[model samples]
Target: MPRPSEARPSGARPSAQVRRFTPAERWVHRATAALMGVCLVTAGCLYLPPLAELVGRRRLVVTVHEWAGLALPVPVLLGLASRAFRADLRVLNRFGPHDGVWLRSALRRRGPRPAGKFNAGQKLWAAWLTGAVLVMLGTGLLMWFTRLAPLLWRTGATFVHDWLALALGVVLAGHIGKALGDPEARRGMRTGFVGRWWADSAHPLWRPGD
Candidate 1:
């Protein structure tokens, strides 16, 4: 009988199964958002002729433009498909009267933050972003599948799409700039676990126990 052929193992090792991203899922999250960012920036550029050169090639930009729109919203949808995302969203989403107090204090130039898992500003940002995402996705589908809409609906969709694009462009710039300003803040989302102290300090109310 021929000697058993020396071969690689049939089963993957336990170490091989362990993953940070269950198949690059974190990277996928980053990639989809990055593509969406490109689409938004390019479209915003086309809003003014002076910015067009940076975007370049109208037809090519348009091609990239639509594809990116189609690509984003997918990951979020997939995230929503998960029970954990829903649970986490619920926790991240709850708003409280203390949040208002926090907001008022900040507005009054008081550096003191009302302790919680999230401050008023963070809650407002989260709430506003959720609405923006819904509006963007809904209007995007209208523009993406134009044939489904009558002339009036299509026209309305176009206007809303353009306006939202402009508005969200500016808002997201602030969002990204803030992220870049803080190293720990940026890492929290990537790791999905903020340092316990970071969490406590940043969101006093949301501290693990209280």
Candidate 2:
């Protein structure tokens, strides 16, 4: 076999990059994020007295928040038209032996653990956020159309919605922090491609098929 230096011409760059996301997947993610941001901002303005006073548009804020929350699931539903997205959903859903190992290693602060395209933490976050968004939507609808439900139901929905919105905000901040710290991950989500070296080091078990 040829030596490392002889494997390619001098100054040649590595070309083993891979596509990390599809165009449809990227679009869906962006759309969902946009809608979620709108919902969060509006919710804050509606709930916080100082923010509400500064914004000074109660009716408009409420309208925007309701509409944004209701439409948050649209992009994911539309993304189901793409085979790639559906395949990724399956990957995110299944927890294999490596997932357990990865989580254990993570908690123990051990050295890097083998992982696939999505790690155990990412999979859990995705599953949780999906459920949370759906619940928020349902509760929001109940609160919006108050006449559709009785007083007790509306009261419970309001309680859940308020607490869940706070939780979502905190979780979202952590997600953004992680994304900001990982340039390769940000690049992959933004441009749909990631360096082969990054994949090899961070997600050793990841394969193109996965």
Candidate 3:
């Protein structure tokens, strides 16, 4: 084993890192995220008075909304349970000394946007969003089943669920907004393989043997 002094240089080309996510993992993430997004958008629109009027079929909209909400977490939960997903979680959660520097520099348009496999912001986003989903799901279930908690608490849970949903929606919007602003990022998830430069620049803290 090599000592720290003998370790590979930071900028040196690394040995080939295998494509991490398998097709099933990709499918699960995409499907769940897509469904969750649709559920949020549709439900949010419907919640607004004007959108309720604009919707052609109220019952159909509600049905689809409910179904999508239920389905959205399946893949995410599955991913969380798998080792690959857990490993991904670790990489995303890893905060490096460079992350802060990159963040500060990026504020001035000099930050490492494509530094590693994931960056500090993206990791934090993933962690919080997933946690928010879990909370919302729990509250949603209590409301749906109508007997998990006290009647009063069940009502309160509804309020909590809606509030968290709204908060999560804001974060989700920001996440997607950032992705859309950079076509490379949008392509990463779409193609399930981001460019070499993107990984190098965006996620400098991420490397193999992590």
TM-score of each: 0.72, 0.92, 0.74
Q: What value does the lDDT take at residue 70 in candidate 2?
A: 90
lDDT of 2 by residue, 23-121 (tens): 999999999999999999998999999999999879999998889999999999999999999999999999999999999988997755778989999
Those runs of model 1 whose alpha carbons end farther than 4 Å from true positions after fitting are: 1-32, 50-56, 81-83
Model 2 residue 132 CA deviation in Å: 0.3
| Candidate 2, pairs of clashing residues | none
Error of 3 at 182 (Å): 1.8
| lDDT (Cα, tens digit) per residue for candidate 3, span 102-132 | 6777688653454356666766777887788
Cα lDDT listed for each candidate: 0.64, 0.88, 0.68
TM-score of 1: 0.72
lDDT, residue 64, candidate 2: 88
| Cα TM-score of candidate 2 | 0.92
lDDT, residue 68, candidate 3: 81
